[model samples]
Target: MIGSVANMLAHVKNCSKARKVLIYIPYSKFKFNLLLAFERYGFVKRVSLLRYSTNRSEILIELAYNGYYNMIQDIVQVSKPGQRIYWKKKQLRVKHQIGTYFLSTSNGIKTNLDSTCVGGEVICNLV
Candidate 1:
């Protein structure tokens, strides 16, 4: 069972390389919420929830691009199964690079720019 966040994100990167319009991914609350934040940041287009089982669902993610070039140049997982990394509001004050920081905050998954309250685990950096 490939359920790790890193594993799931790898699939997304692969889809971007393939230049697919849309891709379906196994849904987790964290991943779903993160994708919503991505949508807000213009990294993705549309998102639709697809119910498969009582306890399981899937998300159809419409990718975004710039004139055939994949918008997401890179996606890197920071905190992982072995070593976990956490960040704070002050730590995130630094301006992110071409992409943004997706963090688990008190409110929910949010980009560093949008995060106000104390930040939690640093999930992934999206470029």
Candidate 2:
């Protein structure tokens, strides 16, 4: 039942708030790409794929922090099943340079660092 991106984002946000060393999440390609984006921008320490319950797979994400502060100040789910948000290439705007967005682009999942410009659902914003 916990297969939605919103659920995953909420889990990550909660883990960040608790300052968990490691968090286990269900396998999802989009999730994997999203984690990679976070890692690319130094928001996360590590991401590993491991077998879970012998048959299924899971992702282990290592939260990043400096001193006593967590790297992520807040993470908000932008596109949901109930409501979807999309921005065209012309409308693309990055509110925060340090903030990163998980976008479901036509080509694939992309981060703000990439400048190709794609129009798709904005999954979540992480900072």
Candidate 3:
């Protein structure tokens, strides 16, 4: 399982098509580690970290793609927080059944997001 996960991470790091990445971490420590890693590798351009819930402890990361497609396949291995999210791509139709806010770029481009939750609406913007 570890090998397979590593292989997937490698693939993501090698992908040359992705332009943006969004990561959500629920813990401050883990979020800090991820931020350090990003800085160490210089993988993304702009990164936004948002605090979700206090009791639950969650974070949301928004990464802007500059021109580095070589870091897409890198897989982050960590246990999901009480409230966590993962978004992979930036081009797809998004639908939300519950009350949710949709965040997009000024030009309005569809962002790619791979989310795993018990129940919630998915939001994205490709710009």
Q: Write down the lDDT of every candidate, Cα atoms only.
A: 0.83, 0.79, 0.36
Which segments of candidate 1 are over 4 A away from where they belong?
Answer: 1-3, 95-98, 115-117
Order by TM-score, highest first = 1, 2, 3
> What pairs collide in candidate 1?
none
Q: Which candidate wins on lDDT? A: 1
Separately for all candidates shown, the number of backbone clashes (residues 3 or more apart, or on different chains) is: 0, 0, 18
Better of 2 and 3 by TM-score: 2
Whose TM-score is greatest here? 1
TM-score between model 3 and native: 0.33
Candidate 2 per-residue lDDT over residues 11-125, each given as its tens digit: 8899899889899998877788888878888888999888867779999999999999999889987777767888776556646445677778878777655788566777777
In angstroms, how far off is 8's CA in candidate 2?
1.2
Error of 2 at 14 (Å): 0.8
- C-alpha TM-scores of all predictions: 0.89, 0.86, 0.33
List residue ranges in candidate 3 displaced over 4 A: 1-20, 68-70, 76-127
Candidate order by decreasing lDDT: 1, 2, 3
lDDT digits (tens) for residues 31-97 of candidate 3: 3443444444444444455555555554444443555444333344331324334333332224552
